[model samples]
Target: MRRSTGHPRVRWSRRGAAGLVVLLALALLAGCAAGPSQRPPVAVRGELLPAAPPPPAAQAPADPDRLPEAEPLRSGPPFADCTDDVLAGLAAAGTPVPEGRTLRIGCGRLTVPADRNRPDLGPARLGLTKVTAPGAPADLPALVVLGDTGVDGSARAAARLAAQLPDPVLQRYQVIGMDRRGTGEDLLDCAPADARAALLDAGPERGDEAAMSALLERSRSIVQDCYLLLGGQLTSFKAAGSADDVEALRTTLGLARLNLIGVGDGADAAAGWVAGHPGAVGRVVLDGPGDPTLDEPARTEAVTAAAESAFDAFAGACATGPDCPLGPDPRASVRRLVDRLSGTALPVGDGDSLTAGATLRAVRTLLSQPSRWPELQTALAQADAGDGAGLARLLAPLGGPQGRFDAALATRCNDSRVRATPGEAAARAADWDERFPLFGVAAAQDLVACGPWPSGGQVAPATPQGSALPPVLVLGTAQDPRAPQSGAERTAEQLGNGRLVRWEGAGTGAYPRTPCVNAVVGRALLEGRAPAEPVVCPP
Candidate 1:
C-alpha cells in the first residue's frame, strides 16, 4: 500500500483539554441509556437471537491452563538505555535508523501451546517485536499495537509512531507489535491455498446451495488443515484466543498496563481485551471498528448498505462539481455504472478483469475514504468510456487494493462463526438479497463462504463493561461506511468513562493524522482530561 501522502496539517491547541474533559464527564453521566439502540429488524421479529454470554472475568491464569491468561504491561528502566542494542540489530538487518536514535527494540519468540483449549499440546513459537522508549516515566503508559491482515504495515506504523513521539512521552512508554496467532512469521505451513482459491472462485454473487456447500467444504478443510499442520496445536484461532496471545506478549514485555491500538478485525480483539482483562487496560483506540457480536447476516447487510450510501454521497458530490469528469449528472452516471457493472465482467488490465463481484468490492474500498471520492468518480467516468484502466488503478492497495484474498478470507473465516449447511446459507442469502436489494446478494454470498468452517470456537457475547480507568476518547466519522457513527455513539454510552468525538465525514476515525483529534487524545492520555463538548468536526 502507498504511504499516506501529506502530513496531517490541522492546527493543535492545548486549550481544548478542559472542554474535552467536560464533554466526556457528561457522556459518562448519561451512561448506556443515553443513546438510541438501532436493533436489527430481524432481532425484533424473533428471527435471530443474541450471542451467548462470555466467560466470567477472573484473575490472570497462573498456570499452564487450557485457557491462556491475561497479558501484563511491560515495564522496566526507560527504553532509551537499550536503544543501542536495538539499533545494532536493525543495522545488522540493513534497516535504517535515524542518527541519535537508538533502536531499543527487541524481537522474541514465545512458545505458547498451539491451542489454549488443549494446553497439553506442544507449543508454537509466536513472533513478537518490542521497542522501548528512553527515559520513560515511572508511571508512563505502555502500548501494544495489534497487527491486522499483513504484519508489515502495522509493524512499520508502530515503529514510526514511536520514533515521532515526544521524548517525554517516549520515555514514559514502549510499543509492542505482536503478530496474531496464525499470521506473519507464525503462519502455519498447513494453511490450504486451494481452500482459499475455492472460496474466491465462489465469487461474491453466489447465493445458492451448491455454491455455499463448496464454500463450506473449503472453510472446513482450511480449519482441519490448520489444526493438523499445527499438530493439533490450535483448534481454532478466534479473537478471544488472540486476546490471550496479547496478554502473553504483555507479560513477556513486563508491561503494567495495556493501551490497545487495534485496526479492522483488530478492533474486535481490543473489545475482547477489555472484556477479558478489564482493570489492566489503560486505554483503547479502535480504528476500522466492527461489531463482532452482530449476527452474520445483519452485519453483512449493515456494511453493504453503508458502502452504497457512501457511493451515493460521492456521486452527489461529483454531480455538483463542474470539473467532475462524469459529465453534469454524476449521480445518474454512478447508477448507470453500477447497473452495468453488477453481474457483468469486463477486462480491467493486461491480465485482470472487473467481475461484478470485484466491482462492488472496489466500491466498498473506495467508500472507506471520503477524500478519495473524487478519484473514484473519475475512475467511474473512465470505466463508462470502456477503458477499465482507471478503475483497475484504483483497485491497488492504496486506492482500494487488498492483500492475498485467500489470507483475508482464511483469517475472517477462522475469526467468526458460520452457517452449518449450504441449504441454510442459501436460504439466508436469498432473504438478505430481497431485504438489501442493492448489496444484499453479494453480502449474503460473502458470509456463506464460512459455512463449511469449523462449527465451534470460543465465541464471546457483547458485554460492554464500563471501564473504571481514565476517560477514553472514541472517534467516529459521521459517514464512515465501515463502522457506522451510531456504533461509536453506542460504544461511548457503554463505557463508564467515555466520550464520543465526531468527525463528520467518511472512513475510519481520522484522529491519528488529524492534529485536532490527536491533540484531544494526547491530552486525555497525558492529563486525564475529558472533552467538555462533543467534537462535531465539520465537513
Candidate 2:
C-alpha cells in the first residue's frame, strides 16, 4: 500500500485485477478478526460514506374499533316522473296518501335482474316513492325508508313516515320508500284453498300427534306446490338480492351515499346493504331489526320467548284496568281462552275457525302494537264469549300491500336456509309448546312450511365485519313481539360499527314512538354523531 489511502482507485489492467483480489482477501481476514456490526461502510471516494438509515419501524394496522366518519352525500340525477303511476298504484291497492304538507312527490320503478346470480330469471321491478315537503330544499339528501318485508307497501310506508317524522328531519332530507321485488302479487296462490285453510288449524291440542301430523302434511303440500308453481322464480326472492336492489336504487337516484331507516324485516335488508357497501352508507337506523344470522331454531326460540314475555307485559298492563276483558289475571284469561279454543274451535265466518294457531297469531300481532292492546282485549273478550269473529277480524290481511301473507311466507322461507323436516318441526313444536306454552307451538309448527322450500341457497343477507363503515344505530324494543330485543342486540354486535339503543317498552319498534329513541336517532342522522355508550329508553 503506497500511502495506505482509505479509498483507492484501481486501474483496469491485469496487475490491478490481481492486486484487487489480494486486497479483498486481506479485508475479509480483518473483518473476521472484528465483528460485522463494528465495520464501517466502504467509502466511494477519499471520504467515509454514511450508512443507510435502518428500515422504518413496521407500523401497526389501523384500529378496527374506530368507525369511519360520515361524509356529506351528493345529489345525483333527477328521478323520473312516476307520480301518476305511483298514485294510481296506491289507489288500486286501497292505500290512502299520507296526510302531511307534501309539496311534491316523485315515483319511479327500477328494473333489476330477478336473480343477479342467474341472468335467465329475467328482470324484476322495484317501486320507488320520493316525498318532498313544501319548505325542504331541492338539493337536500335522500332518506330511504324500508318497511317490514311482505306486509308494508314502500310508497305508502314512506308517505306515512314523511307525515310522522319531525319537521326538522324532513326539512333536511327527502324521504324515499322502496318496494322490494316479488311483491304486488300473491305467490302463495299456488297452494290449494283447502290446504291453506287446513294449515291455519293450530288446535290439535299439544301432544296430539295426529293433529300435528295433519298440519305438517298440509304445510309440506302448500310449500311444495308454491315451489312447483313458481319454479326458479321462487328462488329469485332473496333478502340478499334485495340488498343489491338497494344499491341499484341508490345508483339510479344518483346519491353519493344513502341514509336509510329499516323497520322490522326491512332492517335486515338495510343491514345487508351496509355490510356489502360500507363506503356508500351515509347514516343508518335499524328499528326492531331482525337478526338473520340466527338459525331457524334459534330464531324461533328467541321470538317465542320474546312473545311470551310480551304477552306477560300486555296482561300486566291490562289487569290494572277495570275494563280489561282479560279479567284480573289477563294471562290466566288468555290461557283459558287458548285451552277453550283447543277443545272446540270457534267459527269466525268465511269458513275460518279461530283455532289455537289463529288465536296465537292474532295475539302475537297485537302484542307488537301497544296502541292495539284494546283491540286484543276486545278479541279476547269475544273469544271468551264463544264468538271467533273478533279474533278473525284481527287476522284480516294488512292494508298496505296486497298478498301480504303470501309474500311474508315466501320471504321468510327464502331468507332462511334451515328447513326442518316434518319430524323435526313436530319435535321443535312440542318443545316450544312445553317451554313457551302460548306462542312456541305455532312458531315451531310454522317451520314445516319452510321444510319444502329449496335449500343450499344463501340464508338471509350477509353481515360483514365492517371496520371502516360509519356508525350504525340499532334500536331494540325490550318487549318486541316480532323481532325481539335480543335480535337487535345481536345485530348491533354483528355490525362492528353498530351502536345499540334499547327501548324498555312493549312494541315492535321504538322510533317515532319514544322521545328518547327519537332523540338518539335524530342526533345520529341529523348531527352525524352516534353515541359511544349504549343508550336505554324508558317506556
Q: What lDDT does model 2 reach?
A: 0.65
Lowest summed lDDT across 10 adjacent residues in model 1 is found at 8-17
C-alpha local distance difference test of each model: 0.53, 0.65
Give the local distance difference test score of model 1: 0.53
Candidate 2: give the clashing pairs.
Answer: none
What is candidate 2's lDDT per residue for 1-539, written digit by digit as tens? 00112222211111111233334533533422211211112211111111332122222125432333333335433355555555555544334455544535665555566566655545555556678776556667788888775345565567657766877787788888877654432122344445555555554264345556676677677665545444456665566766877787676555556788888777877888888877677678888877656878787788778888899889988989767877898888888888877777777654446777567777877787786788779878888988877777666552111235556666777787788766787788778778887877778767776766676344343455443576789899988887778778877877777899999998776888889988988887677778888899999
lDDT per residue (tens digit) for residues 159-218 in model 1 = 544655555445655676666655534443233444543443344457788877777677
How many collisions per candidate?
A: 28, 0
List the RMSD of every prediction in angstroms: 16.2, 25.1
